[model samples]
Target: MSDGNAKKTSSKESFLPQIFYNALLVGIMAGISWYAQKHSVTAGEFVGAFASIPLPVVLFAMVMDYLFDTGSLYRKVAGKKGLTGAITALGVAGFFFITMTWLVAGTITMNFSTITPVIYVVAGLLTLLLLWPKTGTTHFVLLYYIAVQLITKFAHFTLLGGVSLG
Candidate 1:
């Protein structure tokens, strides 16, 4: 390949790792915040909660989230091409469906009775409608992931006063 082509490929490869790193960082921060909120009995106990979470659990959650987001994006963009693609798409969709169900159920148990699992399912379907033409670009996936996280956290705070473990 020409030097110009090589440079382009290298740049593209470099961009993916950066995104992965950023996702990992975000996941860790979210995990720590979740731990603090769940374990604290008072404001003073919040800081101590960080040290108590097992490192493996934090890493696992972050890694799982990162992989799920990546896989979902891949399925959205390329999973219509062949049999493998179809299987991958199905797997990714199934995983997200289960995850959203659990999230909705958990949030509901935290006293957010008005927010049902159907709402989350509908929101996800709407997002898919918006993303269909866009082909699941990395930028779009990242933004969507962050938005979901923020919304989930906000709901937790609003409904439970950020104190109760759901």
Candidate 2:
């Protein structure tokens, strides 16, 4: 590729999004504690901090897959049969968490436990949504997952720390 194109591509892939995400996560943690203090004495700062952990959460999900016979994730979910639906849901959620973790950590020091609760809530919701009696439409499942992800993350920040996203 030409030097001009390379430069343009590099500029487009700037670290703005990554920096923004980190700031947002930290803000959420602080907000969770502040919000909780309004109602109760404890700010729930620990919960907020723990919610930021991602490795353990991903690890637990992997273990769950092994125990539940979620082998060959691709084949099982390709046809959307039986437990395959649930497996697919888990795989997608897992991938998101893992990607988010790597983006934030990026070889720097990190506190894994800080994100566990958030991941736990997300994975739990995904599992439940996948297991629920299907409406025969995958669209609903995907929508449900997205909705749950937003709601849970919001609640984790607000209720736990009184933190506001905006």
Candidate 3:
């Protein structure tokens, strides 16, 4: 007779490919975040677009996890493949942040220049660092969207000359 352990092992193996698929989809959605800034004309549009993307991203990540037959925590902290996937996901999230932030800043009577793209990159990184650990996929996506909008608005007002403080 066969041991029970064999059946369990087979089950686990079967499930992991699903997990990998989920993670990849998450990465794809996160990557899309970068594009929002270009399309946004107002803060409402920015928030709307940013709010909408993460569920699909997370759903993809979940599917990838199932496909890979891996656990979330395990893959999140494991070897090279895991790390690479996370980084790609983060990159997608970054794009979303930049797009939404630009939208909000435009609403506040601020002037945005081509250089704003550089600022968006930098701010996106900082927000990700702060929010990623404390928040899961959904919260991280939503909060970053909001944070980018407000912070960039304040920064534009304080540091830039477009508003003409004088």
Candidate 4:
């Protein structure tokens, strides 16, 4: 029974090793975003590159933070391990937000540096809600993917949304 209980525990033991892997991937992606900010030539070019990444991660995380539950609410929170996982997930989500927001801002206009921060400021504000205990998602792999999409959707509107890849 103890083994079964341990298995049922979410976001802790299973996720710890994964944190390093995901963090490394996120770090690489962040570097790519920085590269895009500094090196990309035109808004259209940037748009194409930005749109190339799979996304809408933000919307998923929002749902997880607010609406997602495995009927696991009855179980006690997973203590420090769970907190670590959530915080790591939060950081992972943050990188996704920054990278995609920067990319999407580039899609809107080449003068993205000035506006990117402002856009994600709102994103950051919205992300704060994840602090609530409601965000007990078991899967960080998808959250990792969803973060980029969230920021993309937030800033897209018509400007970046319809960016012609031609």
Clashes of each: 0, 20, 34, 6
Q: Per-residue alpha-carbon lDDT of model 1 for 68-138, expressed as tens digits?
A: 45565643434244444445544554565444434323333445445443334332432342223333333
Error of 1 at 99 (Å): 0.6
Candidate 3 lDDT over residue span 78-124, tens digit each? 22244465565555455545543443233322445533343443334
lDDT tens per residue, model 2, 1-166: 9999999976654444334433443544455345444435332433343333343443443444443334454334433433444455446645644544443233213555554343333333334333222322344433433454464574432222222222
Looking at candidate 3, the ten consecutive residues that score lowest on lDDT are: 157-166
Poorly placed runs, candidate 4 (over 4 Å): 1-61, 64-78, 82-90, 99-112, 135-160, 163-166
> What TM-score do all the candidates reach, one by one?
0.31, 0.24, 0.26, 0.31
Segments of candidate 1 deviating more than 4 angstroms: 1-80, 107-117, 120-123, 126-166
The RMSD of every model to the true structure, in order and in angstroms, is 13.8, 18.8, 13.1, 11.9
User: Using lDDT as the measure, which candidate wins?
Assistant: 4
Stretches of candidate 3 exceeding 4 Å from the true structure = 1-80, 107-122, 129-131, 136-166
How does candidate 2 score on lDDT?
0.40
Q: In model 1, how many backbone clashes occur?
A: 0
Please give the CA lDDT of all the candidate structures: 0.41, 0.40, 0.42, 0.44
- Relative to the true structure, candidate 2 reaches a TM of 0.24
What's the distance in Å from true for residue 56, model 1?
Answer: 18
